[model samples]
Target chain A: MLVIVVFVLVGIVTALLWASLDAFGGNVEQTAGVYSTIIFFVLLVGTLVTPAVSGGAINGDRDAGTLATTQVTLATTGQIVLAKFLAAWTVALTFLAASLPAMLFTVLAGGVRLDTLAASLGVLVLELGVVAAVGVGLSGVIARPLFSVVTTYLVVAALSIGTLIAFTLGGLAVQTERTQTYIGIDFSVGGEFDPVTGLPEEIVCLEPETYSYPVPRFDLVWGILAANPYIVLADAAPTTFTSEGYPEDLFGQIALGVRSAQLPIVFDEVIDECGAALAGDPNSAYEFETPQEIFDRTVPSWFVGLAIHLVLAIAALAAAVARTRTPAGRLPTGSRVA
Target chain B: MTSTAAIAVEGVARSFGDVHAVRQADFEAASGQVTALIGPNGSGKTTLLLMLATLLQPDAGTIRIAGHDPVADPRAVRRVMGWMPDVLGSWAALTVRGALETTGRLYELGPADARTRANELIELVGLETLADQPARVLSRGQKQRLSLARALVHRPSVLLLDEPASGLDPAARVDLRVLVRRLAAEGCAVVVSSHVLAELDEMADTAVYLDHGATASAERIERSRATARDWRVRALDPAALAAALEAESIVTSGTDHLGALVTVSGEAEAAAVLERLVRAGIAVSAFGPAVGDLEHTYLDLARGEVAEQPVIDSTEAPR
Candidate 1:
């Protein structure tokens, strides 16, 4: 029943988004970008629902008095936990499967890159599995069903939103001072101004003025974003660039946010307008890097985040197995094996 | 056929934090007999059963179920042991047949064999009509029957039944008794723990009395059995029976609707009292101990324990 509701809701939302993008004369690539954004939204909803699906898998059985009966059977604790993990993962993946029609529609629209599609879906699937595994493991470890389910949600929230908050606060906490110099042409010194070009006929340079200001050192704390599931999804996907070197999709845009954080703040920047005019050059005072350039210069931390999540999942499952093993050495308070 | 113990525990002890659930439980149940684990409400019967079922670990001693150590090799014990817990719990969403089949599968039975076994167990437990219904809708007694069926899915040799008859009606209880006896006759060692002494008296071939988280020693149980207990002596004429009892020098404790109650030290003394009553021209219609064997022994042991230690153990109550 939940799967059906998710399917219908995703279908309606996808239809609305596609119609809006088409009405705005969005090209195939832009329409595909909107579709990816819709999928990301679906993934967010899936994360919330997956824990509910898997959170009570083990403890619910125990509360109902069925866990010990199964444990007394030939099945080992490892097999029981593994089976529950597999069952929960399958149930969670159903929501992803429900959105397949919309995904197919986006694919048929002719702008979705093959590598981008593979990478995004792959990460989304693995992330859902990780959440399910964590939920099942916690259900085994905790004695009560309600508390375990709530704990699963809290863990997911910590990864999805807590990491973003930590990264922002950490960057703000560490500040660095930067010195900048400014120089310009002095038109008053020239005999007559060139009206057509809005400049002096004879170039005259002004004195260089320098000033210092505090800048947030985001580069120092960019690694924190690697733990965020959304950031991991966005950053792991292969980003597409337009002719102007700007990202064309939401994945690239969010990915660009983390990549931009990696660039060090310019401490001794100089706006040498007077020197440029004297050298007979135009637009040499401002220097900026594109999203693609920033992406290239910085390291990809999505793999690191994924590895951390995998390790967490494995550790939780191992603890659960130890707790559920029988003849159990010690049980949690107010709990019975049979 | 060998005279080995089907279920054996030696100096077993278990505790939960400050409360010691089972201080020392030592007993052996051989094949082809029903052993009654007799104890009061808080005597740790269920705790001892859990340890034997391999669901719990003993803090101290060793347990062997079907010749395999439960702690060292629970799998081997589980393969030959069936436990019906006092608490009845079933999958709410699954039908009775479905639950049984699932249990069979968990025991490594094939699909076809599991289906066959489930059908057989449903019939044996007299739940044919409710086999297809979800277990949630079943009554307490019906759920108890389902729990029994699930435990017997693999036809285990050593059966542990804790409070198995608590919720059963008279007819169902009779059926359960017959079934349990039949299983024992088939060479299965059955351990039944219940608060109903009369029921155990009817079914149990042997009795193990536990008091204050400890099983009473054999010598202690024998001494308790030799303690003076009331015997009911029914007669056609109440006046004549009372007079005969007075003449026989047997002390009459009291009298109720059925007959007069006389205190007797042991079975031989009770027989002597009856012989004297009949010789004195009293029409004795019925003569037997006032309480069931298990109740008499259990109460005597409990009283002895309290008398031995005036400071009552508050932890003796059930959790």
Candidate 2:
């Protein structure tokens, strides 16, 4: 049922994007956008459903009085835990599989790159597994099924939305003052018309105006965004750039947000419009780095986030194994073996 | 020391934090015999069985099942030990046969063997009618039978049944008793813990009485067994029976709806009292101990009268 829901939702989103992009004259950018959107929805649904499926794996059995019966069998505690984790992982993956047709439709439209596809799908699968593992692990560690299921949801929420909130607040908490000096072009005093330069032949400059304002130091807190699962997926995918050096799709767009955060705020900036006008080029003063350049220069944080997630998953399962082992040394409060 | 003893516990103790669930439990159950773990509620009977089943570790002292220490080598013990917990839990999503088959596979049986074993257990437990139905549809008694069948999937040599007869119907209870006896007769060591002393009285060959997390010492058990208990006497005429009892100077404890209750010291005294009632020209219809043997001893022990009595010579006492 969950798989069917995933397929329908993903298919609808894909179809909507396809129709809209086609109306706007479909291209590689539209196809890439479609692919990224579908993958994102799949990840969202996968994380949301995994906790419900896996969160009661162990403690529920204990409550129902079946845990000890299995414990008495030849299967060890580790095997039982691992089996549950695997089962949950497989179940979670079926949600991904359900979105495959939509992803394939986008792929057939000719925009999603091979490396981007491989990396995003791989990370998405692993991320889903991480959630499943955490759910099963928490189930074993906690005494009650309801509490464990809720705890698993909280963990997912912490990783998904909490990181974003932290990044925003942390960046804002430490503000830096930035000074801007603007040298305006005195259009009233300039003499007429040089069509080639797109500026007046004689230009008069006004006194430079200086202003200081506070800017949030996002560079100091950008690492927090790296912990977010969506950001990890965005940052890890190989981004493609348009001919003018702009991001072509949603992944690059989100990746650009985090990557640009890595660049420190310039304390002083000068807008020399009058100087540029006098030098016969009016727009040269506003030439800035493109999104592609910023992306290329910033550090990739996806692997770090993925590693942290893996460690968290392993730790939860390990704790569960310790707690669920029979000939159990000690039991959680108010829990019974059988 | 019976070298053939399938279960041996020496000073076994276990506690849940401040609540000592089992303390200083000591007993041995030999193969080919049914040992009843007799106790009242909160008496640690289930806790002791958990230790023997390899699901719990003793806090102090040792437990050996089939010559293997459950604490040190639970796997070996589990290979031969089957436990039916007092809590009847089943895989609600699976059918009765599927649960048994899954349990057999968990015990390391191959797929074909598991299927065969599941079929045999379904028949043995008399759940053939409900074999294809999901466990969630089962009543408490049917679930109990499924749990028993699962425990027997691996053909364990030592069986530990905790309150196995609690939810059983009378006919099912008789089948369970017969099946348990047959298992013991086939050289399996069976330890049954239950609140139903009368059922145990009919099925158990010997009993280990536990009270307050401790097993009654053998000497204490003997003393309790020999303590004087009430006997019920029913005659054709209630007046004649009461007169005969008074005429014989037999102390009548009380009278119930059935007949007159007299306190008899032992089997010899009970027999003598019956003979006198018959000789008094009163047709005695019922003449027997008021309670089963295990119930009498259990009651005596529970009432703390076992320690006050000196050992009595009850050579002819019916066990």
Candidate that scores best on lDDT: 2
Q: Top TM-score: which candidate number? A: 1
Worst 10 residues of 2 chain B by lDDT: B310-319
**Judged by DockQ cut-offs, is candidate 1 incorrect, acceptable, medium or high?**
medium
Per-residue lDDT tens digits of candidate 2, residues B231-268? Answer: 99998899988888888898989999999999988899
What total of clashing residue pairs does each candidate reach? 0, 0
* Model 2: chain A TM-score against the true structure: 0.95
Expressed as tens digits, the lDDT of each residue in B1-319 for candidate 1 is 2338998788999887767889998888999999999988778898899899888899998888888999999999999999998878899999999999999999999999999999999999999999999999999999999999999999999999999999899999999999999999999999999989999999999999887688899999899888999999999999988777777778988999888999988888888888888889888999999999889998888888878987355554332
User: Which parts of model 1 are misplaced by more than 4 Å?
Assistant: A191-197, B1-3, B237-240, B243-249, B279-282, B311-319
lDDT per residue, candidate 1, A193-297, as tens digits? 777766788888889888999998899999999999888999999888888898888898999998999888888899998887777663666676888888889
Cα lDDT, model 2, residue B173: 94
